[model samples]
Target: MRRTDLSSGARTQPPSVDRAGSGKAGPALILGAALLGLGLGAYAIERIIPRRPMLRGRVIYRDGDYEIRDYPAFHALEMSLYGGREDALQRAFERVSGADRDGERPAALLDPVMQSRRSNAADGDDTGFTHGRWSVRVPLSAARAADCGFESVDPRLRVISVPAQRVAVLRFTSTEDVAFGINRVMLEDFVEDEGLEAEGPVFYAYYGLSRALPFGRQHEVLLPVSP
Candidate 1:
């Protein structure tokens, strides 16, 4: 299976092993061992790594990995990705970390960076995406944006205030494109079943750093809903 490095937004494939020898017992044993290893690794990562604070929100409803959350208006650094996804992510990170601003204090990192597709009007297919947008919540008040001392170097980058919203979210693991597509379908179905009116396009929320293994990583599909 392939996994993403959340820090860099890079995909990595795990090493494959040959199971030709030792009969059917070999494959079963390998599977069991892999499961055990993953379990142990997840536990270790949880215990050893200090997690970053996630954007605060109140959960008003919950069903398995699905939830309706009420989030307060917050400030976020956002940029449109017209180029490669990886390159855009790296540039955003550099700006967030103050690597671009010499001698300045880096902004506090937050969990669950949000990304959404930017559809071209010419594209007939709703599922077709031309580019994307990436946004990361910053520890700053929307009321006092100027005090934050954050400035955008790229024309596409800007600091914006996201209004308070009621959102329906579907939580899942794995960074695979198929996983995202599947969850989006499930989330849309859930919204329809609940009779909720979707107010915006579907966006993805990615949590934690790349140090987290694929099994332990967290991803969410979120859609704004009418109150």
Candidate 2:
């Protein structure tokens, strides 16, 4: 796929991975093993890690239907994804979450972008791969997140309200990167368990980074409430 790495600072093209030429042994095996180990290591770190207080927050705005919570680090995390792709959101979660295998949900974390649709069917973007748009709005009083903790509010805790509604939420553990998949599994389980029909994509928010020191990141997956 033609793409650029927009994870870090500026966007840059990444070297393509050639599948055919990778059949060679020696270095290929080593590289593959190295990558496997790296993935496993990340999983391990997230599983065993503890949590820590990152910030306290509350909902600041309601977008006709949805509420927005403002966190100090929200901008840094949201902007990491060039597009609102679920894969990108998962990676961002993993990067920010400081947990190990024991407490990480690899799915459920999602980019809150508006899904864009083709104006005409002939546009040929029918794959629906990039159909959704990712977006976030800062609350008017978002800067007060830090103050909430001083008034006895736990910095590690947060709340979001869309008004006049409640949602069924599913929880799990994972560094943000893979939270989406885990969330998906959990959501499916919830749906089957409760026999509730879904009207659309799930709703949610990223709460404290972690309960442990540096490296801990946490968030929640929320489903929209139906009347």
- How high is the CA lDDT of each candidate model? 0.69, 0.41
What tens digits encode model 2's per-residue C-alpha lDDT throughout 73-144? 332112223343455444444533322122333221222321212222234544333424443212212343
TM-score of structure candidate 2: 0.33
Best by lDDT: 1
- Candidate 2, after superposition: displacement of residue 227 in Å? 5.6
Question: What digit string (tens of lDDT, one per residue) describes model 1 on residues 40-102?
Answer: 988898778767667878999999999999998877766665433334454665556452344
Per-residue lDDT for 193 in model 2? 67
The clash count of every prediction, one per candidate, is 0, 50
Q: TM-score for all predictions?
A: 0.66, 0.33
Candidate 1 backbone collisions, by pair? none
